[model samples]
Target chain A: MSVSVAQTALLDKEPQFRHAIPTRDGRTARNRARYTFTVLAFLLPSAIPLLLFVLGPMVAAAWVSLHKWNLLAPMQWVGLGNYAKLLTDPITGDVFVHTIYYIAGYLPLVYFGGLALALALNTALKGRSILRGIYFLPVVTSWIVVALVWRWLLSPTSGIVNTVLAAVGIHGPGWWTDPHWAMPAIIVASSWKDLGFVMVILLAGLQAIPTELYDASKVDGAGWWRRLFSVTLPLLSPSTFFVIVISLINGFQVFDQVYAMTGGGPNGASEVVVQQIYDLTFRYGRAGEASALSWMLFAVVLAVTVIQVRGQRRWVTYG
Target chain B: MAEALLTARTPARRTVGRAPRSREAKLRLAGVIVLHLVIIVGAIAMFFPFLWTIITSITPGASLTTTPALIPKNPSLGAYQRLFVERPFGQVILNSFLLAVITTAVQLVTSSTAAYAFSRLPFRGQNVVFGVYLATMMIPLQVLIVPLFVELKAFGLLDTYLGALLPTFATAFGIFLLRQAINQVPRELDEAATIDGAGHFRIFTGIILPNIRPAIATLVVFAFMGSWNSFLWPLVVLRSPELQTLPIALAGLQGQYTSQWDVIMAGSVVSVLPMLALYVFAQKYVIQGVASSGIK
Candidate 1:
């Protein structure tokens, strides 16, 4: 009986195969050539710009990293000199350390804050959409605007934050000015701006989860916390992993806010790698060192991303 | 079926235990109230900075006083009027808008064509090419700024609007996004079009483009926002005050008028308004785009 059934299946598929083969075979060499040409034509426009702006610059940047050349001066080769400076220079080491501190403070706040917001909005609550829009407002606003406004609000003496603190009979720390509080202030502001983005991504993750799992967990006598841990978190790990990688990459390139708000200020207390690169190239006219710094940053980002990609296998679950 | 089971179990459970049900309902009500209260506080915190900026911008003689007023006692548009008159605020806005618009348009064209080839047209080493393209996304614009600037100088395109615009024209993110969208278009449609003697361009322009309008819109929003908020590259390239974009100008204004809180606040408001309007209108596309790209 099984042999007869297999025979019937093959017999049924034979005619369809006969019908499909001729059509595919009918295309001549000229037609194939034309099709190939069409693909090339379609690809060329994007490829040129990508090569010139992105690909070419990448190679050129690598070349520049090995040489000492100001805009006016002729190039002088300095193999590994800039990279050596990255190790020996105290400011570079300090900036790299500050960046790690920033990531330490920033990553958790953004992930947790974003996840908390997403959970709050995920319920069948009234006006949830409006609340979402309110949270998302800062994400769309320009960094310059965000940084400037935050600077005003965190002003050491007369800012609203300090005013509120004084009203509670507590002295507010000098936020952007004080060395101790500067990184924290920046971390808070940066997290606030980015919270909406992470929240939205996680919300998407949350919404994609089927309701049956929650119902099943509830039927199994699981309470809210148990259900969240067992069902939601396991399922949401993919998005969480995404948020971690993106936030980490962005954390390394933390320039705009620092540039606009702190200028790596108060004796380089809030300095980050990108800001250092900016200063090295423009302020100090050390183009080669700056390029090397940029490459170092790129390598760090690449390494982190590779680690995340490899690490996700241990935690992230996809259904 | 599961929902039906839940409903059945809920009703039966409630009927068997009235007192417990009432207590549960009460607890749920209280929990909801607390949740809403927390969300409201968060909302206020999120909106407060913009509110303070607007208030400061409107308040005459707004300054760094011990007590910052939440509401302006005497609001005026004087700061706004002075902003445009005292600085090239209008010119800056124009430059930003022009660059953003041009960049968005060019990226859409380049990204769509490339995305189409990647998604529909199978060729040699397609995966390698795409992998290279995606890898470019990992390289932040900051890494390329120095060399890109030098290259532009070599081409004698430095300080031109074209210089500010060129680096933005082709984005790996845009291509990746558009390719994702194009992949969703069924291959059957392309085959059908090919059977009718329609070429690759015809199908891309007619069928695929129409089907992927949402992706196009998403790319448009991303590209526009990127150019609008772009600071580091534009700062490095455009040295002249006349060629300065909005964010660059705002930073410059803050530097020149460090003590003029009102004027700086006004500049912040002006710089933020266009983006605010865009977000308000295109919130769905923006969120959807971020969500889709973010996850995969």
Candidate 2:
């Protein structure tokens, strides 16, 4: 009797289908077919493009990496020749080293700068919104514009930075013009542009932390420094981990700024992985080698991301 | 329990707050001032380059050999005029605007549909398909430029806007964001619509779209900004000067006008102003989106 009542209720609920309701197995089969068709229909617009452009090209990249073909020439089956060349090339090694150097400098500076901004602005202060806006302005600006502005600002002789430094009775380096200073200059510009993005993410994390925890810590006779170290940093570790991963990924792919500001100049001091790939493909016409180097970069980025994900277990804390 | 906890904590707080109220207020005021001062300095540091760019752009005859005055004695729009009249900048700006708009619109439609499918429609291999989309997000554009360029060439799309727009149409990030939003819309809404004999299209258009307005707005801003500020792909694909986008044009100007700081700065200002305007209007959406997703 209960089963009959439930059946009636279901029939009443789906009134439009009451008269046409088929056998259970037949209905289920028809519904499944309908669902499959609808899913395909909905997915078609994006799937076509993703498959044609993104997914297809990814496979093509791997296939191309194993062969040699310039734009106008016939293809040659290279079967790891490009990989052998890329692995042995001293310039490829230098490019990787430079990319690492950039990450080494950029990761710390951007992370700390962003952290400080996030911490400070997380407080209750008048016009903090405006301050956040100012800090984040560069993140929205195109890298090309930022790079050009920085190149002009660090113009060695007549730039404002050096002018201000000279006012304090200090000499300034040639910045982008100086080989030793080129990567540093790029790092500075990059960090300045990116710190705001980091701050926004970290600020969200900061706001997510429960105030009750702070209250409890205070009730336990903990000082501000102790609370910060034991409570704040530990609780903030997940956001910190995220920021580091993003910064590391971006730092490895540093291109537009390097391309515009220094052009990997001052005798190849700032030649990075992407810039090198671009040069090899477009400039030197070593299409196979360029494809191979890009794959190498892919490997490195993947390895780094995997390691971070695995390493987060030791450091990251969850509430 | 709350009263007990408050009272228990009051004694410790009172000891720490033993100083006179007025004195403590004064100290707090001092702290606020110091905080403001530090932030203002940092703000200035962040804003100075923009300020300097504007100053140089208006200062006629500004050069790299000598610094222009902080406050220009005679500000002029000569450099901006030169950008439009003497160069192909007018067309370039238009191209960037057009491409950004079309890209944003296409992405909104594609991402929303795909998001709906992933959220509501269960198919065989659904998880695997979704996983493929997520994994693709890890492979940066630099990794696929070579093959993409060749593929475009095969289709006779190189150096065209089609080539540039095709690769950016379906972004994994957009789909992820929209799917998250679609999931939050109560399933009952769709079920009710279904009971009312509403088809999937009608339900999607009437229920889901209306419910996820904020997510749509966020996607619009990101897609527009991503297309507008894109440099690398356009740089690789576009060869004709007439087809140049803003970043490529700006880079070209930088290389061509090695010492003409005024004109280069002018281009920089022009390129940045639209972004600044969009940012001001959409600051909340942009900030909230970034905070939530950590997307750059």
How well does chain B match by TM-score in each candidate? 0.78, 0.76
When candidate 1 is compared with the true two-chain complex, its DockQ is 0.32
Report the C-alpha displacement of residue A199, candidate 1, in angstroms.
Answer: 2.9
**After TM-score superposition, what is the CA distance of residue A85 in candidate 1 from its true location, in Å?**
2.9
The superposed Cα distance between candidate 1 and the true structure at residue A162, in angstroms, equals: 6.1
Clashing pairs in 2: none
Error of 2 at A137 (Å): 2.8
Candidate number achieving the greatest DockQ relative to the actual structure: 1
Write candidate 2's Cα lDDT for B1-296 as tens digits.
22222222232344455554676445554555676688899999899777878899898878755555788989999999999999988899999999999999999999999998877775668767876675566555765887788789999999999999999999877786676556545466677888999988998998888666656765676688899989879998999888899988887887898778789889988988786666555545544644564211
Runs in model 2 lying further than 4 Å from the true structure = A1-45, A122-124, A151-174, A177-180, A200-243, A309-319, B1-21, B86-91, B109-143, B153-160, B173-219, B235-244, B252-259, B285-296
lDDT, candidate 2, A1-319, per-residue tens: 2333222322332112122223455478777677677878999999999999988987887787888877458779999999998888898889899999999999989999998788777765567667877887788777765886788788788887898999999899999989999999999999999888777666656654545566666667766566667667766775687578657766777888898789998999999999987777778777777777877887788678777756766776533
The chain A TM-scores for the candidates, taken one by one, are 0.82, 0.82
lDDT by residue for model 1 (B1-296), tens: 22222232232334455554576555654565676687899999998777877888898777755346777888899989988998889998999999999999999999999988887777778767876675566665765876788799999998899988988888877786666556534455677887999877888897787666555765676688899988878998898888989888877877998777788889888977786666555546644544454221
- Count the clashes in each prediction: 0, 0
For every candidate, what share of the true interface contacts is present?
0.37, 0.38
Cα RMSD over interface residues, candidate 2: 8.6
